[model samples]
Target chain A: MKISRIVSLVIVLIAASYFLVPLYATFQFSLQMLRGQWSFQAYRSVFADPNFLSTLSYSAVTSLVAILISTLIVVPTTYWVRLKMPRVKPVVEFITLLPLIIPPIVIVFGYLRLYGSDSLLPLTVSSAGTNLMLVIGYATLSLPYVFRSVDNGMQTLDIRTLTEAAESLGANRSTIIFRVILPNLRAAIVSGAFLTFSISFGEFVFASLLNRPAFGPYLVQIGQDRAYEPAALAVLSFALTWACMVLMQIFANAKPGASRRRRGAAFNPLARRKTA
Target chain B: MTVADDLLNPPSQGGSARSAPAGLPGAKAPRRANWAWLGLLPFALFAAFFLILPIVYLVTGAFQTPEGTFTFDNLIALTGPAILGSYWLSIKLSLVSALLGAAAGLLLSWALVLGGLPRWVRGAFITFSGVASNFAGIPLAFAFIATIGRLGIVTVLVRELFGFNIYGAGFNLFSFWGLALTYLYFQLPLMVLIITPALDGLKTEWREAAESLGASHAQYWRMVALPVLSPSILGCFLLLFANAFGTLATVYALTGSQFDVVPIMLFAQIRGNVLYNPNLGYALALGMILIAGLSNVLYLVLRSRAERWRA
Candidate 1:
């Protein structure tokens, strides 16, 4: 028993080191920008670059838009599939999973081919159109995750009961979806949105291929030329990814009613009249 | 089980949402059923425009000539030595990383789940795995480079501490093995996240039964535990393989244009730089899709078979 425990400890320690060593090395290397002293000079240099702020903000805004688009598409489809059309569940699920099989580079390649300047409904003709296409591409990439997250969330609820209850109170389909269903799905949507945000924020192939000034391309550009700054940027990017995961974990673990109560009561007719 | 299984599994076993509105007039039922598919329009449009249409475009383009005439020349060009070598290297690299990542991750998961570790250790590792699994692409490459590059800290530490020069011993961090090692940064965590559940599903009674039947530990593992775990393990390995195969930014950042991974070659083709063959890029993309798709299909099959154990 003691020997087994010791073996387990050794294995855990080795795995932990594999996960931690690179992060530790990167953080230390980022601090070595000064000639002979540990410093934040690399981070300072990175922060001072205007391109850093610009590209990050651009990616942030674009990712947010993509998240919104993904949510708007996924939540409704999942709701409808569960509540109204269970027969088409297979089709919806297949479409959602298609993104996983088709690599992003290939998807983006297809986008350039089908939506190029010469094509009908040419989305890549103008900068704005191209940005729109980029957002759409991001939405496509995130479809599987958002769909699964939302579907998992929906599974926890008795959708038929909720919808029927809402309908009995004279609520229309849109009102029930916007109020009751959306409120209940808040946690799921937020987690999915965070995942989407993280993915799109540092997405390289789509943003780079579309010639967008996104954070991923900027990171790669810096990685090509700079040394310490790239390390600092890596640390920063990891922190961003860590932040997203932590936020996702928090929201995912939150009790369904913890945050949903207020929104549900505000929009729910039965609760509104009873509270009044 | 995978999300595919979760989705195909009926959402509610007893409370069929479609039956809820049965109190309505008989005429309304058929009309409602017909109109139900309209709710799927927005999602269907998005999928068609963004996902399906683009892929269909590429599949068709792969068979066309430069002037839009039909030709098999592009697909035939994929057989050239350079392109074939790129595909070969990619397959070998992905296979190596996936196999190593799966073995290491399975060991770690087993150590955590069945090796009698404290509960908090498992929790912390799972949380870390969640972060690390998603922490891929360009930043990941930089992290590896910072750790093991020519002037990296590990290299320097090993040199100063033990007088052992790694790069001097031809331990190039920009080569195939280096990239495979780096791929593990994400792949290992992904395997942990996926395989942990399967590990958890291994009931204690199975081991107890094996012991009561006069089986040794190795016999128990080989005769009982491994057979049940094999499907899930193989499925997860395939998932890891597909994940590593499609990776682009990490390899591109680490090796630059020098390394001829198919994705890099495709990137150059799309960029119209050194390789200006768009139709050939289509074929390459098609090959990638087929490989990823084939693995995923096998994973789904394996997952469904693994479900019997879960039940």
Candidate 2:
């Protein structure tokens, strides 16, 4: 036991260095832009660049659109599958997991070939159309994460009982979905949205192939041209990922059961109002 | 169970007898199953257009000549030295990185979960793993470059502090081993995130029972724990393998299209930098899909085996 404890300590320390050294090195290197002393010149220069602002915002907006579309597609499908077509649950899950098995490069390659300017559909003929395609590509990439999170959330809810109760109260299907089911799935959707955002924000292969002015390609461009600013961008990207993860953890820890309990408690006042 | 089941799947007469007015007419009951599929139509269409068709196009394209005639020339051409060497190097890099990541991640997870660490340490590691697993691609390459490249902080620090020249010892960050090290950044955390739950599934009572039956620690592991954990461990290794195999941006940034990975070769081909052989590009994509698909299929098989043990 004593030997095991000692081994554990050594393992933890080694793991810590492995994870932290790169981050520390990057942060330290990013400050070397001014030369001879630590300074924020690298960060300031990165933020001041016109390409940085444009590409960052472009990726951010693209990520938001992707998240919205993913939510709209995933929520209804997962809910319907859980409520009615339980037999097709595995099929739906398998389809969503395809993106994981297929690489992004391959997927983008297919997209370019199938939808290039000379293709029949020709979605990549114009900039706006290509941007739309990029959004769809991101939605496809994030399908597994969004669908699984929402499906897990739905697993915690008694959808049948909730549907029956809402039906008895004269609520229509749309009302039950929009007001009842979606409200309950708020935490799951938010967590899935954040995950999608992080993925799309740093995505390079799709954006580069599709010819978009996105943050990922911009970072790669800077990596080739400038040194310290790339390190600065790396630090900023890491922070963005860390922030997304922290938010996801918060939502994940706020499990459905706790919220449901609070909602149940809130119903007592309504019952008292009816009694009075 | 029966009562809940009855509520969920009421008797044919029970539904009409109890709530005929409150629900849709009883006449519409038979049609509900037919129309229920309409709810999934949009998702089905989206998948068919964006997911299924592209793959179908590639698979068919792989066998066609430029004139639309059927031929396996593209696939046969894959035997050329450059393409074959790229695939070989990619497989080697992926295999080494996956093994290295899996072993280290297994040890780290074991240390956190079973090594009698503080409770908060487990939480911290799991949270950090979630972030690090997603922290890949371009910025990851930049981080590695800033840490271990020719003029990197760690390189300078090692030289100045310990009088050891890392590059002088022939460790170039642009080489195969360096790329594997960079891949490990994401691969290790991914392994931890995946295998932690599997390790948690290892019940303490099983270990106690093994001990009480007069088995040594090594015997307990080899005879029982290992047999159970092998499925999860092996499955995670394949997942890590496929992950490293498909990676593009990190390697592209680190090596600048100089390295000969399958993905980089395919990237150049797609950009029309190589001779514009669209059919050959399809074959290349097909080869990549086949490798990734085969690994995932094996992973699913092993995962099912792991699930059986849990049951």
Candidate 3:
């Protein structure tokens, strides 16, 4: 028994070292100059760099825009597919999952050929064009999450009953969709958006290929040049990514159980009704 | 379980909201037609310009010239002994890492499932795996460098106490082995994430029945467990293979793409100013897409088979 316990403990320690120790080392490395002197000079260089702030903001803005585009695209499509085109559901799913199926290298190469200045659509090889490709790639890359979550949400709903209820109350079709169904679909959409942003923020291949100075590029550049800041960036990115995942889980958890709990909370009529 | 449960029964059947009432014969008709028709556009346009067009062009690039021609020369060039070495080397590295990952995950899952404290360990295992699996690419490469790179603490420690300089002792982080070791970070977590669910897919009755029939541990695992989990295991392997195979930017940042991996080979064409072989680059891209796509199709088939077997 003791032997087994000791073996298990050893495994756990090894596993922890395997995962966490490297990250700690990177942090220490990023905090110093390459000459073995501990200094914040690397971070100072990183922050003082001209290209960084733009990359940061551009990435943020592009991620937001891409998530918005995907939301506008995914939500309605998921709804319509669930309602009417159930037979073509597999095709829709394949379209959504094509990004994962297509390797990033191929996609990046195609973008250069298809979207470069010499190509049909003349999006200049600047931040905007790069952002456009990034948006397109990020949107499609995120489709699986967005579609699955929204589709999953739609599946739980009785669309006919909900529409009937709202319609009888004189809600227009547009109002019923925008107001009633969409509000209820919030959890799924929020989760999808957060996941997309998390992914886009850390996206490497697309940013590198496009030569877009984004957060991912910044991290890479720092890693190549300085040490400590890259570690700081990694930890920061990890925290940011973790926060997004936690947010997604929280939102995902806010489904049937959350509604029930809210209803249960609302059972106290004297609490906030007229008190509303 | 919550997600799986929610997936089995989701919000599309909620207590409220429905379409316009069936008044005239065409009332439901146009609503269904319009909404459904409109939904197809976004999916179609996006898939066309981005997915299909790009892929078709990429494939064509391998064969056609900037002027115009058809040839297999590009493909021929890629399969030469020199390129083949790197290709095989990449395959070897990804295979080793995948195997290592699988072994680690299998042992960890076994421990969590059979241990006295299942939930606590399982929860921690899964949560950490989820975070770590997604925590790869450039940042991870940097982390490894910081921890184990030249002048890193580990390197310094080894140099002082063990009379071995990791960098000087031929432990080059820019080498093939270095890249593979770095890849192990993502591979292990990925295996844990993918295989845990697969392990759960193993119904407890198989083990019990095998035990009741007087089978030894190895016998039961070989006869019952292996067959049951084969598809997911295969799918997991393909995923790891494609992941390591398609990796760029991360390894490039570390080694400057000189190690001649397929991803690096293609990327060299993309970024090369000297050779300027766009056709070769495109063909290489097509080869990459085909490799990844075929693997995904295999993954889908295997995953479906597993689902059917489970059912």
Top candidate on TM-score is: 2
Off by over 4 Å in 3: A1-9, A31-51, A125-127, A170-173, A257-276, B1-35, B273-275
lDDT string for model 2 (A1-276, tens) is 888888988998898899999999999999998868989999999988999999999999988888888778888899888887899999998898888778878887888878988799999989988999999998888787788678767878988789878867877667778899999988877877777677679788889888899988898899999989999999999999889877866675565674333211111110000000
Q: Distance (Å) between predicted and true CA of B268, model 2?
A: 0.9
Q: Model 3, residue B273: what's the lDDT?
A: 29
Candidate 3 residue-wise lDDT, B1-311, digit = tens: 23333222223433123422323343544433444465478778887887788888888878977576888887887787866787787678767777777777666665665544437766776667656666677777777777788877678877899898778768888787888788888777777666666777788898899999999878988999998888888887887777777777667768766777777777777777223677877777777787767877787778777777656
- In model 3 chain A, the worst 10-residue window by lDDT is A267-276
Clashes of each: 0, 0, 25
**lDDT, candidate 1, A1-276, per-residue tens:** 787788889999999999999999999999999989999999999999999999999999988888888888888889988876788898898788787766778899999989998899899989999999988888788777777667767877888889878867877667778899989989878876776676678889999989999998999999988989999999998999889878876666662643332222111110000000
- Whole-model lDDT, candidate 2? 0.82
Point out where model 2 deviates above 4 Å. Answer: A258-276, B1-30, B273-275
Worst 10 residues of 1 chain B by lDDT: B5-14
Instruction: Tell me the fnat of candidate 1.
Output: 0.67
Off by over 4 Å in 1: A255-276, B1-29, B273-275
Highest DockQ: give the candidate number. 1
How far is B114's C-alpha from truth in model 3 (Å)? Answer: 2.6
- Predicted candidate 2 versus true structure: per-residue lDDT over B1-311, tens digit per residue: 23333334333224455545646566645554566687798899989989889998888999999788999899999999988998999899999999999999999999998898889988778778777888888898999999999999999999999999999999999999999898888888888877877788899899999999999999998998888899999998998888888888889989978998999999899886484788998999999999988887788778777877666
DockQ sort, best first: 1, 2, 3
What share of the reference contacts is kept in model 2? 0.63
DockQ, candidate no. 3 = 0.29
